[model samples]
Target: MLHLDASSSSNSKAISDTCNIDLNSIIKIETQLQDNPYDMISLVFLLYDVPDTALQRLIVYQRVMSDVSETNINLLQEWYCHASSRPNWQHELLEALMICQLNSIVKSLGFHIPTMRVFYLSSDPFGSKYINPVKKILYHACENIDSTNLKKLKKSLLSYDINVMEHTTCEIIFLELMSKKFITINISQENKTDEGIMYNVENIVNILDKLNGLKKIVNSLRYLQSKPNHDTIKLKQDNTNYGVDDFNDLFDLINQIMPNTLENDD
Candidate 1:
């Protein structure tokens, strides 16, 4: 009878230990995510409440504008691969997840929500700190541009021997112009930076001035001698660092944007 009781007691302890072990075990997010790339990518994107435009701008700030994917899953995957190669990648992933309010994912990865605020990524990485006012204005004008005016603007580029394709958007056009040195930022003073950066807005302003609707957007800069505080411009910045792969992606975009021009050179 005592042997039977001892056996039952030992069996109970084993069951209790098993339960505690199950409760204490940590499940890694990567382990679950590794096999489900599509689902993982989609969840990140879906839960990533930040606007897609903001993400695109961040990509541009990182100089990986070419990786801009219209599709969310592709964009997330590209961003994930880029982030993974960087130092402190896990921290960054945690930061992003936290920003997205993805507590479950964070916990799954064995990270607790930081009690104190830790900014792995600033709320605005690509804001005024990096992009001067002139570039900021151009970015805003580009963002607000409509398809009709975009087509007109592209058609006008033909006169300058720059053929902007039919499918290209204003954002792409702006990037191409910036890449080719058609649009440039000239910083006048090391200090007093508010008035330091000068915009040679001539080429782009002139082109936009010719287009009926776009004229109102960029026309004010036409008369400003040095400091033009165009209230029409609003700025948002995305801060990310680009890797070699990202640079390659950007180069490909530049190539795509200026394919006709490149062929003409040959």
Candidate 2:
């Protein structure tokens, strides 16, 4: 049974401390769904923050099927229509956690948002009933790439390490992972990492602002260009797993915290 005693309170605090997801980000996504149900949604999960969690959510397609589904929101459409849309927009692979989890919210609000590709960190601990329903509704979106851009993308991923927060900029590499259709990217935290080194939303936006291109996104001066990778990973000896299991844990935590959502105050 659920406890309400001091011990329970302590446990709750522990849970809150251990389980963290950007609740505001989740809420904002939900709110957008509430206001614009027909908009497409695309999401990316960074399986490096909270293992076994769906870290980031991006909506990439808007297909209003049934009346119940019509009330849902779509991210891809909104982004395209929005003044600041991300470049190389892939309208097929939207994230599933937020959209599926919010199905009730969508129906209550009287809308629907179709999902596309929502990938997982590595398959373990990342399994969810959500994945099945989402897969039933949408087709898979990634495979071995054949495009020349993929080489560049892989080179970029190598720069990212995907298992070590090597550079001062993590969010950048995380976003880069999302751009390459990766739902999660793992990073090593064995060493005492630098919060100062981890690029925050504002720093990334400033970088984009400095960029000569993508004038629209930069113009918004929005602190966040995209969602931050939120998965938490656990590493073992030899690190042969590198970060898959860790990323999977990230998903689990994401599943727990995403329901509450966080605000972008920082």
Question: TM-scores of the models, in the given order?
Answer: 0.36, 0.21
Please report the TM-score between candidate 1 and the true structure: 0.36
Q: Model 2 off-target regions past 4 Å? A: 1-33, 36-177, 181-232, 235-266
Name the top TM-score candidate.
Answer: 1
Can you write out model 2's per-residue Cα lDDT over 1-266, one digit (the tens) per residue?
11111132233335334322233334555565554432322232311123222113222112233356554443333333431121111111122433334444332321222211123322332222222211211112111122442333345445445432332223333344434434322334564332211222343233334434334443332321243222221111123432333324334444444334423101
**Whole-structure CA lDDT of model 1:** 0.42
Clashes of 1: 2
Error of 1 at 17 (Å): 41
Q: Highest lDDT, which number?
A: 1
Worst 10 contiguous positions by lDDT, candidate 1: 230-239
RMSD of each: 20.0, 17.4
Clashing residue pairs in candidate 1, if any? Answer: 126-237, 126-238
